[model samples]
Target: MSSVTTPRYADVAVGDALPSLDLPPVTRAMLAVYCGASGDHNPVHVDLDFARASGLDDVIAHGMLVMAWTGRVLTGWVPQSAIVSFDTRFLAVTRIGDAITARGEVIEKFVDGERRCVRVAVSAVDQHGETKTSGSAIVALA
Candidate 1:
């Protein structure tokens, strides 16, 4: 199989934008599968009645699930081995049926030890343009 080629450090610049990833709408089945696969079966994410009882309008998507999509955006732009660190914060709940889009932009470039690295600002937004997750990632360059 052919391996993917990512941009070199010398070719990348601060303020460059990473490719965005648009995911399908959040669905109950997706939540259920993620819950099982990730071992994060929180009632708030998969049980509608439990969510309503907890004062939520309906069951919400798992925060990590959304974060994973953001990670996908990063990996899609750069090789997974180039990633040094990644982190995210949940800004808002993701409801079922909401479409999520993951985006990222290079914010800075620096050297850490012998590695050429870039810091990227990343986020995931809902169909309504509300940010549901925000984060940053550090990636080493070839």
Candidate 2:
């Protein structure tokens, strides 16, 4: 097997942009699988009737699922071992049929306890261009 080479500290810049990951449109089936896998079987996510009762027109996707997509954008750019921290805030509900795209950009570069690192601003946006989730991550560079 071949090892993937991560970016070196000296070769990266503060404004570098990571490749974006575009996900297929969200679907009820996807939500069902995610619900079972994540054990977050909130009725609002899988039950349209329950969602309507909760004041929503239809079932929504789990926030964690969108956050996971952002995480995928991060790890797809850099090895998971390079990630020092990651977090996100749910800004809006993701409805079924909404296509999501995960994007990230290096906002700052610094050294933490002798380890070179970059602070990356990350977000997941729906096809409407609304950000459904926003967060940042700290990634170490060799």
Candidate 3:
């Protein structure tokens, strides 16, 4: 965990090693629920045989799911209404049963006209320390 002072939102250069999220381990059932709720039923994320046949060694977790988990971390530091933008890049695959974590840090901050904005670096890593998703976020603070 890191500091959550949020001085960046005040147009000050402040950043810290943001707390990491101990997300529940990935599983087929979890993938299915996300698929059902999000309408992202790519077989490669749910069917092991289909995934292997398609060149993947096994079924993988949805990139967006991991991103969502990463974003959730910021909600505690900054109010949920303060999140203005979130961007992410999928670096590697996350497998079912793997424990994953997300970490973030404030990178830069400036006023976007009248808005107090902060740039945050966010990443999700699997048990192997393999980065599954990485990106930045711009948040508007009250």
RMSD of each: 1.2, 1.3, 3.7
Candidate with better lDDT, 1 vs 3: 1
Ranking by lDDT: 2, 1, 3
lDDT of 1 by residue, 96-141 (tens): 8999999999999999999999999999999999999999999998
Candidate 3, superposed: residue stretches over 4 Å from native: 1-8, 11-13
Per-residue error at 60 for model 1, in Å? 0.5
Ten residues in a row with the worst lDDT in model 2? 1-10
TM value for model 2: 0.95
Q: Model 2, residue 123: what's the lDDT?
A: 96
TM-score of each: 0.95, 0.95, 0.86
Q: Give a tens-digit lDDT track for model 3, residues 6-60.
A: 4444444557666679988998999999999999988998888999899988899
lDDT of 1: 0.93
Candidate 3 weakest lDDT stretch, 10 residues:
3-12
Which segments of candidate 2 are over 4 A away from where they belong?
1-3
How does model 3 fare in lDDT?
0.83
TM-score of 1: 0.95
